[model samples]
Target: MENKYQFETERLGFRQWKEEDKIPFAKMNANTKVMKYFPNILSREQSDEFDS
Candidate 1:
C-alpha cells in the first residue's frame, strides 16, 4: 500500500488511520504503562470506537 503522509520527517511520518490499526491500538490502550497519564485502560470495543 502507498502511504500518503500529511507530514514527514527523516524517521517519522503522519498519515490517516487504517483498519489494521485497531488491534494494536487497542493493545496499547490497554497497557497500564501506556495509559498511565489517562484515566484507565480501554476495553477493545472502546478502543475501536476511539479509533473511529
Candidate 2:
C-alpha cells in the first residue's frame, strides 16, 4: 500500500482519518487511561461516532 501522511516531523507523523482507522481509534478512545482528561470513558459506539 502507499503511505498516506498529512505532515511529518523528524520523529513524528500525522494524518487525517481513513475508514480503516475508525475501529482502532474508537478502541483507543474507549480506553479510560487514554481518555483520562475527559470526564468519562466513551462507549465504542460513541467513540465510533466521534469523527462522524
For candidate 2, what is the TM-score? Answer: 0.65
Judged by lDDT against the true structure, how good is candidate 1?
0.92
TM-score for each model: 0.77, 0.65
For candidate 1, give the lDDT of residue 23.
90
Tens-place lDDT digits, model 1, residues 1-52? 9669989999999988899999999999999999999999999999999756
Q: How many residue pairs clash in each candidate?
A: 0, 0
- The prediction achieving the highest lDDT against the true structure is 1
Q: Model 2: runs farther than 4 Å from truth?
A: 1-3
**CA lDDT of every candidate:** 0.92, 0.84
Measured with C-alpha atoms, the lDDT of residue 2 in candidate 1 is 68
CA displacement after TM-score superposition, residue 13 of candidate 1 (Å):
0.6
Cα lDDT tens digits, model 2, 1-52, are: 8668778899988988788998888888889889999998888788778677
> What lDDT is reached at residue 29 by model 2?
84
